[model samples]
Target: MNPDDFSRVRSLWTHCGLPSRPNGRDSEQHIRRELSDNTASFLVAVDPDETLIGTVFATHDGRKGWINRLAVDPRWRRRGVAQALVAVAEAELRRNGIEIIGCLIEDGNDASEQLFVTLGYSRHDDIHYFTKRDRPDI
Candidate 1:
């Protein structure tokens, strides 16, 4: 999404229990920079009234594509909003020539896991996700 959508996007993230911050990678400035860089896209789904109902961050490292920070408004959950978001994001990644798309679901998010599985993603319990961030907040 554009920088103009940052505030509502951040609110949606928080409402959906996704990570966002005043000090981390999700800042409007950082999002603006990433948008300008064009390596990633912060996509949002809005309703007829233009109220944002979902969001997903799609990015790729010239190989596998990644879907991250997916969030759907609680009011919209169990509807098709999340599936639509993922579909659009996957289409965008495919347009960029990405063949394999993946996402990480933290422990205890059974709903997300189920959603991905329903969307045709295989469940892999064989690998671990490792991250080395300079700070925890980021």
Candidate 2:
């Protein structure tokens, strides 16, 4: 994503009901960090008029690829926008020699879970997710 896309991306996330607390981790600072990382991948889908519709962020920790922040405009859901974003991100990761890619879906987010499953991602029950936030109060 380009530097100018930050406001539109943040708006898209808010419109899609994604959690993005102002001045928090999902703020512009974090987005800028991701965009500046040469090894990271960020994809944005826009309409012909250039309005943001979908987005996905992918990163590789040298071995496995991680996908997150997949969001689509409510008006454009189930129309393959999310899938296309994932495809491009995955392709980029593969080009960088990444073999295994994984995504985290919040519990009860059925649409997201099904989207990944339909794309051939298998659920792994053997592992658990953990977080260590520098500022938990946010």
Q: What is the C-alpha lDDT profile of model 2 across 24-113, one tens digit per residue?
A: 756778768878886688889999998889989889888999887889999988789998999999999999999999998889989888
- Badly placed stretches (over 4 Å) of model 1 are none
Model 1, backbone clash pairs (residues 3+ apart or across chains), number? 1
Candidate RMSDs in order: 1.2, 1.5
TM-score of each: 0.94, 0.92
lDDT of each structure?
Answer: 0.88, 0.87
The residue ranges of model 2 lying beyond 4 angstroms of the native Cα positions read none
Error of 1 at 37 (Å): 2.2
Candidate 1 lDDT score at position 18:
82
For candidate 1, list the clashing residue pairs, or say none. Answer: 1-42
**Candidate with maximal lDDT:** 1
